[model samples]
Target: MLCRNCLRATRAAASRPAIPLLRAGISSVTRSATYTTSTQASVRHTLQTRLPALPTFRTYSTSSSESAAPPPEKPDYLNEAESTIWDRLVAEFEPTELVVQDISGGCGSMYGIEICSPKFAGKRMLAQQRMVNTCLGDLMTNWHGAQLKTRAP
Candidate 1:
């Protein structure tokens, strides 16, 4: 069965005959035909004409003037502390990618991470999350809190 809202929407849509504009796509044309429906009356509208095709996207060669910069190197302290923990966990359970985002305010201590790992494969959502928490272990004692997004590789 169709929902009441859906039926009302369909009736409203049918009542208005969408007028197409050449500048944009079907969406713009449809939006141009929009009208308010009164609670007291129910009536259908009809489209006056067919809409024109959507405008094609233009591509510019910005690369000709601009060059891509190399990614910044991971700092030594990051390698020593956070990277050490990551390396240990990755050694035990390899991952396709592990992203650590430090949100520790001015002091720079706490962090949030997004880990995409094959180790999480075949595991339930809660189990995957728990694995990350377990891997952090005692190190998390110093952290404010962590937000983790773990997905199967």
Candidate 2:
């Protein structure tokens, strides 16, 4: 330990500044100092040289056998006769708001209706629905089921 060269090396190490120790799992970006452009470029080059190239992908061509017809258009939920139910209710009730949905999965057997009208202001829920049923007439018999929700304007 008394050797001149060893003594010089120890003095040199003691004179050098201390580096802050990085904690485990800490990100370098959150450090106080920012990297220079040269440092960033060197890092980019190193990463590019180290990583393997991705496999090239090929484009596919559709053959005549693989080409099929486009899908058929979806069928209408409410046909002309089914749509008239809304019109009849509108004509009779003069509702401020009306919405009718065919919930029969395109069979047009069941309908859900929401009607808001001044006419329903003094009427009970059953009476309001009965009026709608009466307006539907023979069409009501044709329909398998209906859900009626009424509101006063």
Candidate No. with top lDDT: 2
Taking all chains together, each candidate's TM-score versus the true structure is: 0.46, 0.47
* Candidate 2 residue runs with Cα over 4 Å from true position: 1-78
lDDT of each: 0.62, 0.67
**Clash totals for all models, in order?**
7, 0
Residues 1-153 of candidate 2 have per-residue lDDT tens digits of 135763553455456653342333323422113434454355446556756788999999898456633322223565776568777776687776777888888787888988887778889988988888888868879789998898886
Can you tell me which runs of candidate 1 are displaced by over 4 Å? 1-79, 106-108
Check candidate 2 and list the clashing pairs: none
Q: How close is candidate 1 to the true structure, as a TM-score?
A: 0.46
TM-score, cand. 2: 0.47
Q: How would you encode candidate 1's per-residue C-alpha lDDT over 1-153 as one tens digit per residue?
A: 445974676576667776543332233434223444432122221221343456999986767225433323444556445676666566655666776666676353777777777678899989998998888878888777778888986
- Model 1 alpha-carbon miss at residue 107, Å: 2.8
Query: How far out, in Å, is residue 107 in model 2?
Result: 0.7
